[model samples]
Target: MTVISTGVYPIDKLLNGGIEKDIITSFYGPAASGKTNIAIISSYNISRTGKKVIYIDTEGGFSFERLKQISKEDFDNVMKNILIYKPVSFLEQRKSIFLAYDYIKNNSNSIGLLVIDSISMLYRLEKGDEDVNEVNTELARQLQVFSEINRKYNIPVIVTNQVYSLLDQRDKIGIVGGDLIKYWSKCLIELKVYENGVREAILKRHRYLPEGLSIKFKIINDGIIEYKE
Candidate 1:
């Protein structure tokens, strides 16, 4: 496993360098919790490094205005290097998996990184309610396809997941996919939104971390700027 720099100082340090390549690193959190910001920034950095990135946007989470935050330099090639595809419906989103898969399969030399803005949209839309049977049947098949791509391509896949509401009234917050999503994801990152303008990201499930360790961050108009404060 190759750990590449996330480009965030404290975050990189926390991951013992960065997230490993050739696997899926899923980041899950609520709406407007800076999840999309990090995705755009990460994609920018990866693409800037001469990697042909395929970004699949599900919830209109990607933006060039946000990309300028990481690097103010001319983004003529960076933006072009990234092939963004927006899938309007749930079925359309699922089809993009194979579309991206085929593109990479044929144009092996052109692909370097792949990102799905939100995986939750597929699961939620398909199974609007807590239908475990539907998820296990359809969701399992969906993840299996991507999992194959992750292992086969040897290129890193960054998937942004959506957080869900907990059934109980406890203080515990959770992501959308019950055990299936949790089990399928190789890396799990949780972002916390505090009342005092403090955003903290926890490296919950990772081979490099000591179970549950976290690093602080803040969200600005630019995006999720890492500030250790």
Candidate 2:
């Protein structure tokens, strides 16, 4: 299976070379934990290889300025290859996935990665009005569609998730989608911000990687970089 590098050395090492193709890799963390940076860097790196990337932004967090900072002279070319979708609501997000899947089906040879920046944002917003079971079922169905796309097209899917602190379990954080995400994701990574602005990525679960393995990295103006010291 082909793997796409995240464009960060230590992160790629933690992922056992790189993110495996045809699987869903999830990153969950609080604000400023480097989730978006990883997604952007990965998209930029994959696009650099002359392949197209499908980026779905649920939180309005897609930053062209940041992309320009990372891609430098290749900004325009990279943007050309990336087909971005900004879904304003939960329904739109689902529709966007279907549209992306269809696009990939037609252009499988050219598409390399599928990125959903903050997959759970819209879900969280709509959760209060919907039944819990109904929400979960819909979420499962959406993820299943993504899995099918990955398995059939051999495209790597990267999704970012929000984290919430549990009152009883102060030290252990819970991901927004709860157990469903944990069960469906092929690889799960947890990001944490430490003292002195240090950022760390913990490889919580993977098909091949040993649990509890981690790596340290920093988000700079250019992109994600391994810690110097």
Candidate 3:
């Protein structure tokens, strides 16, 4: 099946058996909203199949300790199938994506998923120094590469994004890259923080699922699980 379970029951169910392949799936929210946790858990799940997961960490949020905790005794084996690339700049992020594409093509059938954990971090950093239009164009170009990879390789591209409050609408949250990210992502999930370590994931957009459906989950040391009151 192209759909892979995210290891979180509620999220898997919400995604109709899990994240779909050959498209972009985005998770975005405020800081500490469990965005990175979801990405890590998804990577762990994909690695369990003995398939490589190309993880591009733009925010240095990829955690080996968290993966070990989630994998338990299978940590060593799971780690083998996950390839990580840390890019410190937006330009490097672009290069990493290209390298990832080449690596996947050469390996052939070895990779199952591609993840850019907080894909917007480096771009966010570059926004102030670079021309607004130029930076936006570059960001869109990066996403276009992923889109091409998605279509050509039939691999799922998962990205996490940082959120910003809208200027006129202070209550509403918008993702970095705005329409560009939305255009590429077939599934969009908004994470919300509640009391304690609890968080909510709302299915904001999807190909088949109904929108506005939400599930509360908690990030424990081992992994994420459905939260209950």
Q: Evaluated with lDDT, which candidate comes out highest?
A: 2
Off by over 4 Å in 2: none
Q: Residues 1-229, candidate 3: write the lDDT tens digits.
A: 4787877777897788898888899999999998888889889898998889999999889888888899999999999999999999989998999899888788858888899998899999999888989999989888998888888888889999999998899689889889999998999999999898889999999987899998999888878888978
lDDT of 1 by residue, 46-156 (tens): 778887888899888787777875666747778878988899766787788779888888876767778888977866776766576866577667677777877887777
Clashing pairs in 2: none
TM, every model: 0.90, 0.97, 0.96
Rank the models by lDDT, top first.
2, 3, 1
Instruction: Give lDDT for model 2.
Output: 0.90
Query: What does the lDDT read for residue 89 in candidate 1?
Result: 68
Question: How do the residues 1-229 of candidate 2 rate in per-residue lDDT, one tens digit apiece?
Answer: 6677878777898887899998899999999998888899899999989999999999988899999999999999899899999999888998999999899889999998999998899999889888888988889988998899889988989999999999998698999998889988989999999877789999989887798998888888888777757
77: Cα error in model 3, Å: 1.1
Q: Which stretch of 10 consecutive residues in model 3 shows the poorest summed lDDT?
A: 1-10
For model 3 the local lDDT of residue 85 reads: 96
